[model samples]
Target: MAVIGSVAEFTAEEDWEEYCERLEQYFLANNIKDTETEKRRRAVFLSVTGGKTYELLKTLLAPQKPTENTYEELWQVLQNHLSPKPVVIAGWYWFWTVRQKAGQSVSQYLAELRRLAEKCQFGNFLNDALRDMFVIGLLDTAVQKKLLSETQLTLDKAYHVAMSHESAVQQVEEIQGASKQQVNKVKEHRDPQKEKGVISAEGHPMSQMIVSFEKSCVSRVVTRAM
Candidate 1:
């Protein structure tokens, strides 16, 4: 079948299993099957590979213009070259050392942790380890509390609770900020001395002082006219 957008090109840095799955699925959907004639299958396989993959393909096909081969041979060769033996150690180091950065959202942080976990491939040990790592990496203590308080937890559930709690906290903080701004605006318009109820030496209020000043101005005008 013809594809609409281009299929994703495999890169060395990507998850090996996921990349392989995508390629295999593409082949399966397009009828590039194992039972098919080698000539047609080989052409389709070559069409999909790019970047460093072509180099691997050439090495596998050397001494002859590879007119025929199964897609599985190409798959194995790419996996052998792309996925190194030492990556397990490096993946563990990264997973253990990973911490959530300040201002990073919970979703983004958890997704990163999940990727590192996949690299380790620690079997059944991964579940609780992932859960614990997520809680440990959270930047906010309050959200951490909410996450840990759950009696039975999955990473998915914990993420939901923490994200909702964070949203609620942010909303409350925004409301308080808006309220504080309104109060500040009111105070900005206020007369501080009058609000403090300070009286003049003769015990007249400030309003009387303004009226007296007006009367004095009128008297001065009449005297000038005379």
Candidate 2:
């Protein structure tokens, strides 16, 4: 079998929820069943740093060390230490306060909101809350209006509508930009007479004395100023 990717490394610098998500994705891609404790434990062992592994092993005591062999127990123990109830509550606070930032794309902002939602774990209200948060957090009033125009909007509904609307708007902007470029290119093929300020269509040597006239005007202005 081909290796899909390297194991997810979880160090102190990584966020708990993000690390868990990475691990989950890696597991899914590799067909590593989480229910298989031995395989999960082996994967976890390879993924974590030596120190983190040691810490996990030390969570159990005496003869009970062997009993803590399962990956579920290890995960639960890590959760207890790394992300207890207070930490999870703080995650929810941050989730509620998150707003789409300036210069952040719609897709990026949406992906971030979804990650924050995972951390918050809003239970049965998660779907509705996700929709409300997504709609409320958008920086673009036009997109928000388009999403809100729907009589009923769930998270999936809002995501699809917003994505489609944003895509359409982007497409129109791109077309207009391309059209403007073509127009400018056409305009750039200017009349040589205008560029040279000579040989006019009216069939004259088109004012060769223009620069002299301009200099005289400037001289007069300067003389008046002095």
Candidate 3:
């Protein structure tokens, strides 16, 4: 039999929702079945969550023992302790105030918007809220204008348009930067005066011209003398 993947122990700094998601995936991968009462699953969770986490869970449960609880009850207890639901108004305040930060990409901004929106409890209007926030929060005025100009714009469409615009802008900058570098290299290799006339062995253009003229005069005088 192949070795099953292991789950990492949860830490205080980690997001409880994300950690639970990964834990569920690990359970699925290992083919650990949860009985109707979730006994097996509950036992596995307690064993795999590490000593410190189990101790924390015991503390959260208080007078109740860990073995007395179902898996769902255990999960809920830990979740509520670690990640209590935020107040709706406070969540909205953050969601409304968020903007695309400097040096942050469109994708990163979108992820932040989603994270903040989770607490907002937008429900059915989630997509609409996300779309509006995404457009207004954009740092690029051109991309914002493009999104606003669209008729009946959905969140999906807006995301596609914004990403496309971001990609195109990056490509143009790269191309222009490369072209400028090539032009500079060519300029460095070329000497305008040398192209027009030969430089003197002494490496001066005016001196070369003067020397040629003097040589010409001397040759004519010598021919006349002859």
Candidate 4:
């Protein structure tokens, strides 16, 4: 069996058949006996082939490359075997692209993704959307609450790291709010006359109102003069 020439290029139906045969042979040679592995392997193969076919169809549809009839034929071929994971694939592709820009290795990303998935209680498709922010962060929290709200997941645990972190954040916000309220209360309690520069009980026009009010003041002045 011949492997498809350059998976990045489109192959004829006969070539695709040969490619599948070759892939099966390779898998068998590796002693791939797990049924789940086989199923996922086939799914991945189809998804990749469908993507390649779609790319080729796009190329053929470009101006001056192929006629409308040829484009329609290729489009039909693409539409026939399109896989269900298109949205997942697109998100993963974008994630990888961004990871590349951020200089993060794919292995590290996958490890972090798996960690997040386990943390979020993702049983199915846990490994699939492990790295997706929407999947593991808030969405995971929401899902856990929906399914297990009446159980341990329902009640917030003080020991849970995520909940602890959230609690800390909330505490800081509450303290800040309380501090602001205190400041506002102080401002509200301040005398309006003092705020407007009019002296009250302390002294009116304090600078000029000085009288011989006390023997202590006279003694301090006498000592200073001496």
Best-matching candidate per lDDT: 3
**What are the per-residue Cα lDDT tens digits for candidate 3 across 1-226?**
4738888788878898998998888777877655753787898889888898899988988899898998889999998988898899999999999999998998999999999999998999999999999999999897788788889999898888878777766655565565456545554656677654654233444444544655565555434422
Show model 4 residue runs off by greater than 4 Å.
1-91, 95-160, 192-226
Listed per candidate, the RMSD to the true structure in angstroms reads 15.7, 13.5, 15.3, 21.5
Better of 1 and 2 by lDDT: 1
The 10-residue segment of model 3 with minimum total lDDT is: 199-208
In model 3, state the lDDT of residue 93: 97
Query: Higher-lDDT candidate among 3 and 4?
Result: 3
**What residue runs in model 3 are displaced by over 4 Å at the alpha carbon?**
1-3, 29-32, 192-226
The residue pairs in collision within model 4 are none
Each prediction's TM-score versus the true structure:
0.68, 0.59, 0.76, 0.25
For model 1, the stretches where C-alpha displacement exceeds 4 angstroms are 1-19, 60-68, 146-151, 187-226
Q: Which stretches of candidate 2 lie over 4 Å from their true place?
A: 1-10, 14-52, 55-77, 86-88, 194-226
* Model 1 lDDT tens row, 1-226: 5753345666777777777677667767766666655566666666766656676667767854434455667667667766656578888889988999988888899889988898888899887888889988888887787677878988777777767766655655565565456555555665667755664333334434544654565455434422
Which wins on lDDT, candidate 2 or candidate 4? 2
Q: Tell me, by TM-score, which candidate is best.
A: 3
